[model samples]
Target chain A: EPEVTQTPSHQVTQMGQEVILRCVPISNHLYFYWYRQILGQKVEFLVSFYNNEISEKSEIFDDQFSVERPDGSNFTLKIRSTKLEDSAMYFCASSKPTGGNTEAFFGQGTRLTVV
Target chain B: AQSVSQHNHHVILSEAASLELGCNYSYGGTVNLFWYVQYPGQHLQLLLKYFSGDPLVKGIKGFEAEFIKSKFSFNLRKPSVQWSDTAEYFCAVNPPNAGKSTFGDGTTLTVKP
Candidate 1:
């Protein structure tokens, strides 16, 4: 089965440095999303993207965070300045626009460690 | 605020034991409910989903869930479980028109042989 693929299974970055997490969603999927899970915490929604723009975002997706679909297949999330609290597992997901009952497929996730 | 609550944090069972995981959501509008499982070092996979059909929804691997609208609950159940069923399960809720979903704190299930 086709699945969403994320790059860099693990990353360690210095505080105040920038990081870009990349994802290649399923070819036919129309909606993309970014979510994160802090250690021992629930998965939290960060943002959703559709039609080359952000459809919705959460408070956790603040000014430092941005998402882009620079190409037909690549979707990326960029953090301008990493913080210690930003360490988490980042998941990218995609789904087809099947009316009201769309189910999303998740990537293996990119573990980000900020020091 | 919209949120999901999973009743159990961890559960241990022997092989062939029946299993049930409780999930409840707090959303007033029409919502879509789902159960996802994550095996060790694997991505989250959809186990089942409840949209607008019958209250009882069956998913892959002989797992099922009942969507009780009155109680705002969608609980996952299995008649018998195997050691392979050991994994982390999560319940999620999303508004019909939205793409973002709110997930519950996952339940860790360990099945002993």
Candidate 2:
């Protein structure tokens, strides 16, 4: 089965440095999303993208965070300056809606570590 | 704000034991409910979903969930579980038109052989 794929299974970055997480969603999927899970915490929604633009974002997705569909197959999340609290597992997901029912498929997730 | 609540944080069971995981959501509008499972070192995989249909829905691996609209609950159940069923389970809720989902804290299930 086709699945969403994320690059760099693990990444360690210095504080105040920039990091980019990439994802390639399923070819036919129309909606994409980014979610994060802090250690021992719930999975939090970051942003949702459709039609090459962000549809909705959460408070956690602040000014430092940005998402782009740089190409037809690539979706990326960029953080301008990483912080210690930014360490978490970031997941990329995609879904195709049918009659108002949308079931998202999640990627293996990229573990981001900020020091 | 919409939120999902999973009552159990961790559960231990023996093989062939019946299992039930409690999930409740706080959303006034029409919502879609889903259950996802994550095995060790694996991505989150969809186990089942409840949109608009019968209250009782069956999913993969002989698992089922009942969507009780009056109670705002969608509890997952299985008649018998195996050691392979050990994993983390999450419940999520989203509005019909919106793609954003709110997930629960997740429940860690360990099945002993």
Candidate 3:
């Protein structure tokens, strides 16, 4: 089965540094999303992307965060300045909107550690 | 203020035991419900989903979920679980046309062999 793939299984960055998490969604998927889970916390939605643009975002996806579909296959999430609270596992997901198969397929996740 | 809730934080069970995990959402109107599982060090995998039609939906590995619209609940159930069934389970809800899914806190299940 085809799955979403994320790069850099783990990353450690200093506070105030920038980080880009990359993902390659399934080839045929049109909708992409970014989510994060703090330790012992629920998974939180950050942003959703469709048609190469952001369709929706959450409060956590403030000015510091941005997402881009830089190429035909690559989707990335960039954080301008990392904070200690930004440490979490970031997940990338993609889904098809048609045929009543809207369930998203998730990547293994990139563990972002801000020190 | 849409939110998903999973009642149990952690559950311990022996092999062959029946299992049920409670989940509820605050969203009304047209919504899609789903149950996902994450085994150790694995990505989230869709176990089952309820969009329309039957209230009870069966999924891979003998897992099933019931979407009770009246109670705003979509609880996951399994009969005679095995040790391999140990994993973290999450309940999620999303609007029909939206891409973002509201996920519950997740329930960690530990099945003893």
Give the top-scoring candidate (DockQ). 1
Clashes of each: 0, 0, 0
User: Model 3 chain A — which ten-residue stretch has the worst lDDT?
Assistant: A96-105
Rank by lDDT, descending? Answer: 1, 2, 3
Task: Supply DockQ values for each candidate.
Answer: 0.64, 0.63, 0.58
Minimum summed lDDT over a 10-residue window in model 1 chain B is located at B93-102
Error of 2 at A65 (Å): 1.0
**lDDT to native, each model:** 0.92, 0.92, 0.91
Candidate 2 residues B1-113, lDDT tens each? 99899999999999999999999999988899999998876668889999998989999999999999999999999999999999999999988766678999999999999
Q: Which one wins by lDDT: 2 or 3?
A: 2
Off by over 4 Å in 3: A99-101
Where model 2 places Cα greater than 4 Å from the true spot, the runs are: none
Model 2: CAPRI class: medium
Answer with 1 or 3, whichever has the higher lDDT. Answer: 1
**In candidate 1, residue A95 scores what lDDT?**
82
Provide the RMSD of all predictions against the true structure, rounded to 1 decimal.
1.7, 1.6, 1.6
Candidate 1 residues A1-115, lDDT tens each? 8989999999999999999999999999988999998876789999999898998899999999999998889999999999999999999998886778867788999999999
